[model samples]
Target: MNTDNGLAPLRHRNRWRFSGGTVDLHRPDLPARTATLGAEPAPVVLDPTRTAVIVVDLQNDFCAPDGWLAGIGVDVSVLAPAVDLSAQVVAAARAAGLPVIWLNWGNRPDQANLPPGVAHVYDPRGTGEGIGSRTAPSRAPVLTKDSWGAALTDGVGSAPGDLHVDKYRMSGFWDTPLDSVLRNLRVDTLVFAGVNSDQCVYATLVDAACLGYDVVLLTDASATTSPSYCHDATVYNVRQCYGFTASTPDLLDALAAARPLDAGHRTAPTTPKDSE
Candidate 1:
């Protein structure tokens, strides 16, 4: 058994713990565990070289004004600021030589797998647009694998070296290749930023924790049109149950510390006043 920075070695082969939480470090043979009950610890200082920023569900159907949520009268403007913040995180991650993984909700073309319970959320406006369903006027699929609505928003996009994974469920790990991808990359730390902080982002964050990945939630870079309470609950849950929450600026500082000579490493701007 070994310890570092007050973390006690676990009786289990791969788990470790500090005063506040437990994290099952990734290993090939065993499944990972998430968090435990205790006081939250100070935010983690990440090793930029070993971390990856996961931009989740930043797709047009979730973030853009002309997309499905907007067409249904949802005020997607609340999610607008995250677009730029996520771009900043991506840029910083790339400059630091960290992988930026875009994990978007990409449904199947035939709509064969979407369950009724999962499809009911889109029926509120009677637009009939749900998973794999197209919008009335523009005819874009709600979230088809290769369709426009499922693509990352205009400003938040994938770069040549960045990774892209299409997820089918709210939790990116469910029936997806996300776990294997991260494990294959040997990435143990995941920085999460994306749309609907309380929904898709939160789900993925929790799943990552359970899978033995150190998780960080970028508060400003993750947007949600859901009620403020939902956002608050997600943040609280993540901090108390999964991992720490941070801003884009905090992550930038950590990355900068790792590479002081990189002039391209810059702090992300504060989110606009209109955002919650």
Candidate 2:
């Protein structure tokens, strides 16, 4: 099945390969690498080849002690636990050959894209500390692109093959290429984990469900600096309304049980593919 010459197009759905004289658009014999998750809202199932883990806003601006939220006097301790847990879940997803996508809030320097309502969320009185007011303590403009605050939490590992999406709004799908990226990767199932369980993570999960992607949230790997009830409600809502919820440990066990070399481990691409 060496497709170096582009003779074999991986025989998978959504993977359109082009070669010297032609484009292979056939969906004749796609492979379904099914992996079962011991998820709540019933035992969830999916094709590992068509699944991806979307790690949302596990960034310093939200999880770090000196991050934007913390600097603004919010207790980031509650969100701190999501850092290592997200890393663990991401590692398992990578080993299983599932694509890992890091979706963080990387705002523009001028903040032209942000509307009045969105900007008002953090700086109610327009105190000049919200989205793009700058003057950050960490030297990196608060959540601005390529800043310290927007970078992934120190321990969370992202590889060369991992995809990174910068979101403008709370929902990653809004005004972002996230959905297109997932579709191009031939992914239909999204596994979610990140900080602020009631905010960005939940918003993105709900949007994903509406778009018809089978979503599964890793509860322990996603937390919030908000009240405990907010976190709990998000988990319950995801299982009851959006998609499904499962623990990180459970996902790891399921991934181990469904270890197939071609299901994103040995056979998955080492570099990002512009098109599948």
Candidate 3:
């Protein structure tokens, strides 16, 4: 199922199977009745049009080779696929006209209110520079704070129509304008992808679910310090506890299908005249 963009179609495996007192058959080719076995009707299909992709803290400190955690035994190799997936998701979202919000972490001059031992390990000021000093491009609408070592890196900037939100906690919505932004965008579903899957990503998903937003965790578009624990916990929580967990390819397919129909209505026809 190659999309128009030249990306291959998402791969789906059939899990359903047909079994009876005397007969058995593969699921995909089985008749609906045989497969259902007197079960209830099929589940309702969700409309992905109201979905938005929220990228959380894909920064130098977490994803790049010379990041703060680089020396802490963080295996960034797991992040390579995530970065590629993120790029694919972004491209698909932009093409389909869906919103792609990048939540970057930034720091202030004073490292006030930081978690104990965090400042010692990760230097906010470029002075004690570690491997993760490169920041996102200035063009991005960043949320700069000193509380957590999650600020957005340099070089990545927000585009003209993109929205930026700031936070001072693990959850992006904890003390930020995230809810308001989602409301304004009419976003009912959120696709999450970013760094530190076990910590920030998990926290955001839990919060998002609590706020009544349908969430999808892009398993391949996220990573953590300890690849084993981070990846395992993320998959477990998303699949069993929080919400739907999908691979980057599946997520891209869903987003591409939903974007065209949803994007047009979310934006205003004319730019508001603030008189510049």
**Quick one: best lDDT, which candidate?**
2
Ranking by lDDT: 2, 1, 3
Which clashing pairs does model 1 show? none
- lDDT, candidates in the order shown: 0.72, 0.79, 0.57
TM-score of each: 0.77, 0.88, 0.65
Candidate 2 vs candidate 3: the lDDT winner is 2
lDDT of 3 at 108: 44
What TM value does model 1 have?
Answer: 0.77
Supply every candidate's count of residue pairs whose N, Cα or C atoms clash at under 3 angstroms: 0, 3, 19
lDDT of 2 at 94: 72
Cα lDDT for residue 112, model 3?
63
Per residue, candidate 1 scores C-alpha lDDT tens digits across 52-148 of: 7899888888777788788778898888789889888888877766767889878788767776666776665655666666663347888888787
The prediction achieving the highest TM-score against the true structure is: 2
Note each model's CA RMSD in angstroms.
13.6, 5.9, 15.1
Residues 88-147, candidate 2, lDDT per residue (tens digit)?
888888787778888999998888888888889878887788876554556468878878
Poorly placed runs, candidate 2 (over 4 Å)? 1-15, 18-20, 27-30, 263-276
lDDT string for model 3 (1-276, tens) is 111122222111123233444333332221111000111121113444456788887765566555545544567666767776777776776565557677756544443644535444445463654322333232222223432234433333334454556555678885577887787666677888877788878888899999999787777788776647767867886767666777776655544444244333334232222112
